[model samples]
Target: MSIDIALYDGHPAGGRRTGARMLRLSSPGAALDDALARHTDPARHRLGRIDPYGDTLFDERDAGAVFEEATALLARCTTEEQRAAVRELRDLLADCAATPGSRLVFLGD
Candidate 1:
């Protein structure tokens, strides 16, 4: 399945964090997404201990940067489909960035 990027008011799965999801670079494979997310900031958007195996992709702080990186990569990939994804990601990032307690989470890798 493709990556599902969304904004949550609090921690997903009924956890204890408060934030929203935003900014998704590309619906690439899990390996690619992890590599990109940790590319610039190694310890930027990391999950919690609950996910010891790192099964899911969750980035709380510095999420905007991660999303920004993804968006930047496709900034010039203006094909119809690419353009839609880019625009959607950009809008989501902007919305979350403007929101106070919004956290951008990239699911499915």
Candidate 2:
């Protein structure tokens, strides 16, 4: 699987904005849990927003590591069920990024 992170700008409210930095995991379902875990580490600054569309910045190195971990995790899944779950999670991520008012900043891995 492949994964990436993106910052999005949804609104302009003075200097405060609303958006989400998404960790996009494009691998199998089994890897979803690991991917989510890897991308949400507060210490590593890998966290993202909860809003439908919001703006946030992330470190490129950290994002790349998270994706690499996710892809490796997906590759180790032993069942189709796990792979399917990863696919579902990927779809959800894509949907959030594709929201009508969202602006995505894709970070290449």
Candidate 3:
């Protein structure tokens, strides 16, 4: 099994809250993680509203640079499996970007 990080549509942290599931990434998604963090820096300059983290929910616009940076990171990968994961991440980001009001709701365990 692999450690997976699942993205949801909104804040779905508590046991009582619910959100739509979006994307799932394999373990050691360092590049993706870093890209997400850089994009969601929460600083005024970054245009984010929260701290730099892949929490339980987020707006697609909030993590705006994630896709580009992740794709750039993918270009440096050396393995087929890693490339595959990046491809999946790229597709997921594309889908999320195209859909307005799309929110990220969870970072699966």
Q: Where is model 2 more than 4 Å wrong at Cα?
A: 1-31, 34-61, 87-109
Could you list the CA RMSD of all candidates, in the order they appear?
7.0, 9.7, 6.0
Going through the candidates in the order shown, the clash numbers are 11, 10, 6
Best by lDDT: 3
Instruction: Please identify which of the two predictions, 2 or 3, would achieve the higher lDDT against the true structure.
Output: 3
TM-score of 1: 0.50
Question: Which 10 successive residues of model 3 have the least lDDT summed?
Answer: 44-53
lDDT of 1 by residue, 1-108 (tens): 345556655455555454333333344334333333333343433321113133343334445554566566355453556556556655666665665555655665
lDDT against true structure, model 1: 0.47
- Give lDDT per model, in order: 0.47, 0.40, 0.50
Q: Which stretches in model 3 have alpha-carbon errors above 4 Å?
A: 1-56, 105-108
- Return the lDDT, model 1, position 78: 35
The order by descending TM-score is 3, 1, 2
lDDT score of residue 3 within candidate 3: 26
